[model samples]
Target: MKQICAFLVIILLTSCEYFNVKKTSSEAILNEELETFNWNDVDEYPSFSSCDSVSSKQEKKQCFTDILTGHIFEYLQDEIIIVTQDINDTIDLKLQISNTGEITLLESDVDSLTVKEIPNINDLLVRSLDTLPKIFPAIKRGQQVTTEFKLPIIIGVD
Candidate 1:
């Protein structure tokens, strides 16, 4: 009887652990989820009203780029630009789109030669952005998020 009681006690002690519930705080779970979440990518790209009906992610992105670059190109073409020397260069236009859908020029990577050839190039880019259609901000995890983009604008003039 003594040996049987000791065996039952050991079984009960070990089995108690199975019934115990481990409590996890909400904050801890949220922190863990955030740690594993990818920060570099967005669920949805910023879009124009024209791009709203696009179904695929890649297509949406392409539509956004096409519309944006087309507007800037058209704006630049509308302006009369003349250069002393034959100029051919690519300007990396860094732009930031706020969560509220406002666009701002963060920086323009213009080479000294390009600057010398076209002093108002930066102004032209800024003015072109000012003419952009109303933008819908990028979406990440169902929340509107600010995003930055580097757009390459080619400048060629004879």
Candidate 2:
């Protein structure tokens, strides 16, 4: 009877040790997984309303960029602003697309001469941005996230 009792105690102790090791390993794995997650890298790029039907990732990205460019050009093409001279320049626009697909114009960099030539150019750009449909924000590990974009617009006098 004493031998049997000793055997049972040894079995119980070994089982307990195994359980403890298992629990520690599981926790370590969870921590490692959390640490490996990257907050800066996005799983998917932001999407435009026009890109929703696309199936592939590259196609979606291209569609979004193309549609946005078209919209910006379309709005700018309609503006009647005149420069002091026939000027051609490029405007660098900084834009942020929020996690909820909201668009914000962060900044616009235009040549001093361009600004002087066409005062309402900034307003025109802002209006064009406002007219754009809501964008689908970028995806990071299945969560929607805000993203920044830099768009360059070409102004041609012809």
Candidate 3:
């Protein structure tokens, strides 16, 4: 009887330990999630209403780009630009789309020659953006997020 009782006590202790669950602190869980989270990528790119219907991610991005470029081109075409010298250059336009869907021009990288030929190039670009349709901000982890874009605008005039 004594030996049986000792064996039962040992079994009870072992069974209790087996049922024990390790408690994880909230900080540790949060840290682990942060480590696995990607900061640079967005789940969905910013889009205009016209681009919202697209299903594929790549196609949505392409649609947004096409619409933006088309609007800028149309706006520029409407204006009569006169340059004495033949101008052919590309402007790297840096833009920021806020989480609230507002567009802002961060900067414009214009060559010295291009700047000289088109003094108001920056103004024109800004004005062109002002004419853009209502934009839907980018999405990351199901939350609206601000995003930056570098768009190349080609300027060719004979």
Candidate 4:
């Protein structure tokens, strides 16, 4: 009888441990699933109004970039910028679009030569962006979300 009782106790202890392990693992799995659903799931990417006609995701993205590039280039193309250095320069801009369709200048990547040449370049860029029409914000599970974009501006002398 003592031996049988010992065996039952061992079984109970092992079963309890098994349940505990499973509970912890299940909790971890639940957290992981939530993170994936939140971060990795994007229903649709942000796009400019001009891209609305495009159906495919890739095409929409391309159209959005093309339209924005053309617009900014048009804005700065006429301006004559003089720099001390003869090296070719490019400006990298990071823009953020809010859920409410507002655009903000997050950061600008420019070299010393570009800044010295055109100190008000950032302001000009912002003004140019202000003229742009509102963009449709990104969507995730039917809700609009803010998005960021990096744009390259290459400067060439005429």
Candidate 5:
């Protein structure tokens, strides 16, 4: 019975979870957990000049992603215009953007996801772009801002 109880205690301490380190049955670690963590979940953490200042790399990355996503709508608008333009005046095109920043710009024939119109359209689709999203400035705590980003662009090539 004692052995089973000990095994149960060990199992309770550690569980397989993605992106997280499992804690062991250690007393010191429990004390750390008990201590209140001083974190401002709302105050987005921006880019830190030194890797040392950042609490965790994941926090930094999330800040970057939030900053990037905020401008995702903007970049999508630019991308549609650039790719639809007649580079050599050989293509016909009409492009438009939505308030949410979805895209619809195609040439003669489309072999993938696209829209016939922009207004009143409903659907959220992810596309890859030839150019990556440019990181925009983001507000962080204490008036500090950070810049980092990710954008996927989908180009249909015949």
Candidate 6:
């Protein structure tokens, strides 16, 4: 009878261990150790915490740094133009926009980049920002730090 009682006691004690819903420190440690660290996420894009609420100019500057660091522009392959037309009526044309605000009509791959455009379009630059003119004029904090941009376009000969 004593042997059966001791066996029942052992079973009860072992079964109680399964009822533990609380996460132990040791368990957390083990889980963290087992998880594989994602280096690419760190090396590639900026984290939400780091990139969030970029309201101030300083924050924008930091965001720009993170953007360039991540090389987010590397994969951006913007087509100059997209047209669906018959070969007999189709023609090839090329256009380019420079940060200098120049709406250049480029004929050759090698062209001068020093020539300045009208409004001096720079980073996040566009030829005619319909929204920008209505929203924010020239963003001047301390001094003018000119940034450059390039946009290419292709048009049909017809």
lDDT of 3 by residue, 44-148 (tens): 999999987899999998998889988998998998888989988988989999999999999999999888888998999999999999999999999999999
What's the count of clashing pairs in each model shown?
0, 0, 0, 0, 7, 3
- Whole-model lDDT per candidate: 0.94, 0.85, 0.92, 0.81, 0.39, 0.34
Per-residue lDDT tens digits of candidate 6, residues 23-72?
57987887786586432222222222344466665565456444432332
Which ranges in model 1 have alpha carbons more than 4 Å from their true place? Answer: none
Q: State which candidate, 1 or 5, has the greater lDDT.
A: 1
Against the true structure, what is each candidate's TM-score? 0.90, 0.74, 0.84, 0.75, 0.22, 0.21
lDDT of 2 by residue, 1-158 (tens): 99999999999988886666434688899899989987656778898766878888888878888888889999988878666687688999899999988888899999888888888888888899899977889998778999887888888766
Clashing pairs in model 3, backbone N/Cα/C closer than 3 A: none
Q: What is the lDDT of candidate 1?
A: 0.94
- lDDT, residue 87, model 1: 82
TM-score of 2: 0.74
Residue 15 accuracy (lDDT) in model 1: 100
Clash pairs (backbone) in predicted model 2: none
Greater lDDT among 2 and 3 belongs to 3
RMSD of each: 1.7, 5.1, 3.3, 3.9, 16.9, 15.5
User: Which scores greater on lDDT, model 3 or model 5?
Assistant: 3
Stretches of candidate 3 off by over 4 Å are 1-22
Q: Which ten residues in a row have the lowest lDDT in candidate 2?
A: 17-26
* Better-scoring candidate (lDDT), 1 or 3: 1
Residue pair clashes in candidate 5: 127-154, 128-152, 128-153, 128-154, 129-152, 129-153, 129-154
Error of 2 at 23 (Å): 8.3
| lDDT, candidate 4, 4-96, per-residue tens | 999999999888866664346888998888877857445787788778889988788788778877888888875676666664678898988
Q: Pick the candidate with the highest lDDT.
A: 1
Model 6 lDDT vs. the true structure? 0.34
Candidate 5: tens digits of C-alpha lDDT, residues 77-155: 4443423322221222232222223233332222223333331112222342213243223343444333222233333
